[model samples]
Target: MKTILFLLRKEFLQIFRNRVIVAMIFVMPIIQLLILANAANYEVRNLKLQVIDQDHSSWSRQLVGHFTASPYFNLTGMVASAKKGITAIEADEADLVLHIPSGFERALRREGTASVHLNINAINGVKAGLASSYAQTIILDLHQEIMPVVELPAGLSSTFRYWYNPDMDYYTFMVPGILVLLVTLVGMFLSGLNIVKEKEIGTIEQINVSPIRKHQFIIGKLLPFWIIAQVELALGLTVGWLVFDIPIVGSLGVVFAFSSIYLLVVLGIGLLVSTFTDTQQQAMFISWFFLVIFILMSGLFTPIESMPGWAQQITRLNPVTYFVDVVRLVLLKGSSWWDIRSQWIALSIFAVVINGAAVLNYRKTD
Candidate 1:
């Protein structure tokens, strides 16, 4: 126990002694958080649309006017025909192309039947889906207003807003998740490469000959990085609150608990990677690759629902998923511990299992 404490103190001093690394550890993430928080919004807007109106009647003009007036739609093209509109959409010039059937006004007024073709690019499935739904709703609302004398079913209403985020501040939703990811990258990358660096420098042999046990030495090495990571997290949260005005409406204890558990998993991953690689470059590359894959799959930049079934299933095993969820829940949704009990359990279990494997794989003797 004494050895462990001594090692922890030693590691802490070694990390803090490097002023440049400490500055980067805090500043880089805040910079990224500030820049990306604005750009990573899920709110759909200015959706480019092409109108292929075959019926050049007053009613068709009115429909086109609906598109022009809508905040959701940006009328980018008024093409001669549906074929041209579809061509524009296929060429990626437009996100949505609406082809009103021939004699649309005649059919609606005289025959009470008309179909509007809607072409939406599903490449970005989530935004495309939302845009398509919004377009459809606007058209329906137009029809309802036009036919006001017609009676409607009793249990139907369109009185709710989606509120992708009610506050509409992108940073509120983004900072928590992205900050967690940024810490994951730092923790995993630095710690994973530390042992490999010592080995490369031939300093590991000296540690091996010392009276310190493997566990003590290992714990000591991690102690400094762990505390630094926590300080970085605190700085990130401070930035989130001070700059973006993002609310942290949940318990700080829960946030700390989950963060500590999540760090264990990240550090375990780093240690495990160190065991396999002999060089710092190899460790760095391996760590970055894993971090990229985990972040992409962890539903940080986009919704997991937007991904395919197999891809979504793959994220279930990623440790970053739980961390992102925990932070987002505590920060944005004000989720209580009970609300995140299952996530806590899962992260804790993964931390234990992964750290155990790392310790097992890590070399003790030089």
Candidate 2:
């Protein structure tokens, strides 16, 4: 225990002595949090719209007014024909084109039905889908306002109440996940590079020839990063609350408790990487390869449920996936310790297995 404490002291001294690492540890995360929280948004807004109105009727003009008034759309131009609207789309000047054929009002009044055509740029499928849905909702609202209503038999009506995030602010959904990412990057990259840096500088040779046991050395290397990562998580959460107004709906203790174990999984992976690699460059490349795969498969940007079956199955193997889910659940949903029990157990097993492998792989005699 005394030996481990001495090694921990040495590790912290080394970390603080490096000015570049100090800046990376404290400054870079705040900058990234500020930038990425605002930039990585999924909401589509301010779509350019072109209109083709052949009827020149009041109803057609009203439809155009609805589209222009919406926050999601900008009125780029009003063309006289469908050909002109199509030309605007082809020129990248319009995202959607509304074509109201001639005699639209006449058809509605005479036959109680009318048709309007929508031409949308479908190059970005997700953006196009959102734009289409927003436009359709506006048209339907106009239809409901204009058409006469008749009393009918009572039926079921559904009302939605969005829990946790009532305003549907994208920041609320994104900040917690981003916090996980930052913590993971710090813990994984720094710890992974620690041994490799020592090896490069000829310091690891001295440690290998010391009286320190393998478990003592591994714990010494792992604990400093584990503690630093927790501090980073706290800093991120504070920034998230102060800057973005993100709420902490659960206990801070619960968050740190899970984080303590999760950092082990991350730091273990780092140590495991260092065990196989000889140089810092090799360690970085290998670490980044695993980080990218883990993060992309972690459901940070997309929903796990929406992924294909095989891809979803792969997420089960990702430690980041479980941490991301657990953090969001605890912070956003106010989930209890029992609520995250399964994840806790899984991470515990990972912590043991990964660190065990890293210890077994580290050469004490060489």
Cα-based TM-score, every candidate: 0.85, 0.95
lDDT per residue for candidate 2 within 290-330, as digits (tens), equals: 99999999998989999999999999889999988988898
- Candidate 2 wrong stretches, greater than 4 Å: 149-159
- RMSD to native for every prediction? 3.2, 2.0
Q: Which residue pairs clash in candidate 1?
A: none
lDDT tens per residue, model 1, 44-131: 8899989888888877788889888988889997888877887898898899998887788776766555678898988998889898
lDDT for model 2 comes to 0.90
The Cα local distance difference test for each model comes to: 0.82, 0.90
Which residue runs of candidate 1 sit more than 4 Å off their true CA positions? 1-10, 17-20, 56-59, 90-93, 110-113, 121-127, 149-164, 167-170, 302-314
**Model 1 whole-model lDDT (C-alpha atoms):** 0.82
